[model samples]
Target: MNIIQQKKDERTRVVYIHIPFCTNKCFYCDFNSYVLKDQPVMDYLRALDREMEMTVQAQPPGSISSIFVGGGTPTVLKPDEMQFFLNSVRKHFPDWDENIEFSMEANPGTTDLEKLSVMREGGVNRVSFGVQAFQNELLSGIGRIHNTDDVYRSLENARAAGFQNMSIDLMFGLPNQTVDMLSESVTKALELGLPHYSIYSLKVEENTLFHTMYQKNQLPLPDEEDELNMYLLLMNRMSEAGYRQYEISNFSKPGYESRHNMAYWLNEDYYGLGAGAHGYIGRQRHVNVKGVNPYIEAVNQGLPRLNTLDIPREEAMEDFLMVGLRVLDGISRARFEQQFGASMDQTFAAPLEKLVHAGLLDTTDEGYKLSSKGILFGNDVFGEFIGSLTGN
Candidate 1:
């Protein structure tokens, strides 16, 4: 069956809106974003509003449990622009869960008290700041426009604006990052006493400045041993600071886990709107047009989709294993059977046994999960589940 027919009755519970404009692009980043210069900003917002309006008319949503406005720095929008965008969201997806988690990604230097007030009044309850490092040299090296002072000032303003539920992102494997440098960054992040933190290793993705530097040996990144030590140090420190490692790279204090991101790791269906956004519904995945003008024009005509394809059963099973295993609690056997109508052991017995014997996966009462050792080599463990089902 085609994607539309299959997903016609599916009720999307999570909504992700992309605002693909940033103050400046980071060196190691490769997401679909453009500099906030000479672009038709209001025109893009109007195009997004039209997309949301048409989306709900086609496949109406249930009580939305989570709404995440991620970006190229969503806070780059002016107060009035933010107001218009949020109003459009409320106009379409009006029915929200009582305890909905509304989150927007902000850059350290972009957010201010006035814009934050607009966000809070518009129903945003959570704000995540992209404060990649606390060191000024590291910040400049990464091509980030914000410095350490902006980080402190932004957090202060966020708190002043009544935003208590906040999180900050940090990076570990940078060009000149060492174990001690990561420790200092972690110390500063914990000192803020926020509810959640997301620290990720820097990957030199293609088409980025960092990738080109790496190819020429200009990027003086930490070696494998140093990077491993850095990861271990941060993990130990976060645990010591009383944060739960709910996912591989996310830590939260008790009830502050990001529900919007958890929805993705749990493989739930969500609406992805705006230019260059991707959405998954029923058993199909689709990506919207990447170019801003092209997307706006397309949505004016109809849905601004570039391509949509149905995910095959085998590929879906592999995805379930791959994404589900990223969570600390791991995949559940009963839920797997409910989703695919087959026993987990029956489908993946060979690889499961292999990983179990290798001490990479431990069998739980409900299902299987990564061992402490397995978390470090997660790619290898996830790879075991990929082609094994087809072989059997």
Candidate 2:
């Protein structure tokens, strides 16, 4: 690449750390993970530290705005281990923004007051708990290790640990979940009065136990109508609870939106490290080796890169729109024009016009956003962007 292109790429400032260990894999989970019993936890952390060193060596960045350590279950680490991991991060990425949002995903069953205290001391300002459901039976049915009590306790511990900016995740349309159950989960989560919520409809992914049961017709998930009711109910309830529906599945109490996730939706550059982590710097997109041993060995050698691709401008613009429109505010026309040097209207004329005609999209004063109808069919709207970009 030329000097000008390289200079533009230097704006990369976000960092993602992956901790690929869980107590036990959930039935619906398909993320890179392994059972935590007898795993080399310390060794993995050292490997991650090495990976971070290699990453900065490859491309030294300016001040980082955010760092998200996602899992397996990050809270699985002991208090001291958590401290070591976070400290290693600060040591490597020393020029972090003062207001940097350092978030870590925690599972309810394992996150305790002591561990959270250590995390707080280590500069973890935000916590996202994976409380998939509020009902114990449903939680067990879905292979979640934590119960409702665990969820409450985890939230309390997080709050006591000085985490005011917190987010809880809930899943709907589970094997035996109904609209009423979904509402109950939302109601319980709202009662906690956290800053943000992410309620997702369960999708049966391949290689997961859920997919196996689904293929055998053993799973009794909510029908399309019931799932639709669940979505509508949660939206209304969240709105009444004074939370804004910022994204299709995410809600936040004013100004509590996730800056790290927003970086992805805004289509900005970021650094990704650890096993199975993905990074996008400039036009090149890359994923580290998904296997833990392979990642450790590769990083020790030089870098842990698995595969890389250079995305075309048209494809990148479509990805930007697809992710940005998931937010209620939607993408900006001026930003799109500036990034791609092409007007959004002129570039995506046919699909935008067709979707708006079908009442699936509404044009705001500044740009286009998904209509209420479009949300239920968000995948379809995003599908248009992808198809239009690749001519598929």
Candidate 3:
């Protein structure tokens, strides 16, 4: 089916609302976020509401199946302000799926009982906390605002506020992180008995403190072998604790997988609102203006704040391969064939053949998935699809 036909007949509708305010930026973060302490917060909220209206008006779909409010730290907004923001969303979108997954990203220090309760009342049911490590010194070393106490308190507050569905983010392969420390973090996380967890390896991106430190030879990151060991340890521990590795960085108990994230992995179309947020719909992609003011002004003037491009069919097929391979289930050859009316072998002949020969990618009963080695060097395999026209 064509992009427009695919979207018009899509089984699920999702929305991603970006909240770009943070009290301070984390040293390792390169996401589109800002520490605009004195910026007009209320005005930004109003602009966000207007943006939501515009998007819905342009592409009204059926009831949304998932809604995610990701950050700069969505919990930074005060309780009343959060209510207003969420209320605007509900007013614009008539209904959400009964099992709608509404998730919000929160930092430990910025959330409290009252704030979480406001979010709960506003229809946010899932909380993902950015708890990088268990050690206070390491937390500070990474420029995290909250201490260990705040982590526990945030979980307590979430539970108290009736948020039973929750997830905690932990990082491995940090500047001085040890396997034992990773074990401790996992132990503590399990003790809380959360339904989901996202454990990611540290990646130093451009314009971040971590990148600067690396350039200066000041970063004391663990050796490659150690980082690999950390990954193995986390995988074993999580599996032993009964959490399934649904995606590369995500683990969850049965029935707790993140619907919003699954939408992306499945290559479904969704609307993304706010500065620097990205949207993919009707087989076209767009990224909003990165700065706060530019986005707000563009929204007010009825102009597209976005740089838009129609996704090439070959490119879309390649993206389907790249992202879908990240899931444990791998990409479905049948679905790919159905979507593009092209054979996978004819499309990704070179990369797939090279990878299969190297034993880094193996064809499975379901489709093609990463071999153990492929998982280690997934970036290289993904790179092969980046500019391939046949695969798109």
Candidate 4:
């Protein structure tokens, strides 16, 4: 089951393009990214173009429904740089759906009106700003470069650039983040009247500065009780404010869910381009080289792959349960049967029965979904299915 390679299936409808450069790295960040100073910005963009060309040639694309450009601070690209990068995207995967979700991650202060106009003109209709927190103290404590003002100004700039579909990300469980602080942040975020919000808890990942602080007992994270309270508070707040908790950490108004992210939660295949990007196609998943120069060099010769693993059926079936349950709609029984050629209940009867008996999962006419109780303890519910089939 380890590192098995498999053929790619048809219909990969998503695209995740990565830009691994930022002005400064956040303390809690562990994504494959680099500081932008002295970096080869243009060279990386050109390499990404080459990769796009090679990737589509290999798999061939159908009409793209979603294209997401993620960080480190994609908005940091200069106007000309942004234009060139967008040109490359259009040059390669040009068959876009009429209602395609062309989203880009932007930092607050980095996106001036000029740059945002370029992005809008370049076919980016949705822009998600990374406004991690509202408090200046909290922002600075987490190594964020923008202040509270930047969030407002950036959103204003985005709207002015003709973007009506917008989103913002906020973080909780940050160092010294009180529940009151989180409440205040939520109040301010809702005031903006944005369509979507992704509020996530902080996980101190390895290779992050926060991890070192945690090891030395210096990271002042909220206690588990407060963190839970914070989560409950936001869920209540968003629900009261007419936002649906469609996924564990995401809330959106009706008809405004992030379609690009839904592709991931639905466990669909996508094209991953650029440095350190990951792509899953057919039953195979591939990751590109991490370093900026290394990715460029690899793309010059061939697909910039660090490794491509073939997902075994048992693992893939388990994956079907793990990620699919994150959505409130849960995994579709018919979808599981369609993908694996077996009945969902018959295949995962043991774990399904256990979870349903525990009241963590409620059986639906269509399939199964997390109960109200289960949503809070989602990790526990998801864990039960890990080794149910293969016992590995």
TM-scores, in order shown? 0.96, 0.96, 0.95, 0.97
Off by over 4 Å in 4: 1-10
lDDT of 4 by residue, 132-227 (tens): 899999999999989999999999989999999999999999999999999999999999999999999999999999999999999999999999
Flag the better candidate by lDDT, 2 or 4. 4
TM-score of 2: 0.96
- Candidate 3, residues 1-392, lDDT tens digits: the string is 88886755563389998999998988999999999589777888998999888887888866788999998988999999999999998988767778888999999988989999999998999999999899998898898989989999999999999999999999999988998999999999899899999999999999999999999999999999999899989989999999998888899999999989988998888988888999998898999988888888888887446689998898899899888888877888888898899998888888899988988788999778988778777788778788787532
Cα error of candidate 4 at position 295, Å: 0.7
Two-way lDDT contest, 1 vs 2, winner: 1
Better of 3 and 4 by lDDT: 4
Screening candidate 2 with a backbone cut-off below 3 angstroms (N, C-alpha, C), the clashing residue pairs are none
Instruction: At residue 113, give the lDDT of candidate 2.
Output: 91
| Candidate 1 structure quality by residue, lDDT tens digits, 1-392 | 87874553358889999999998899998998999998888999999999998888887898889999998989999999999999999999998889999999999989999999999999999999999888999999999999989999999999988899999999998989888889999999999999999999998999999999999989999999999998899899999999999988999999999999889988888999999899998889999998889988998899999999998877788788888888888889898898889888888888889999999998999898989999899999989877665553
Model 2: per-residue Cα lDDT over 163-279, one tens digit each: 998999998888888888888888888888898999988999999998999999999988999988999999999999999998999999988898999999889889988899999
**Candidate 3: misplaced stretches above 4 Å?**
1-12, 390-392
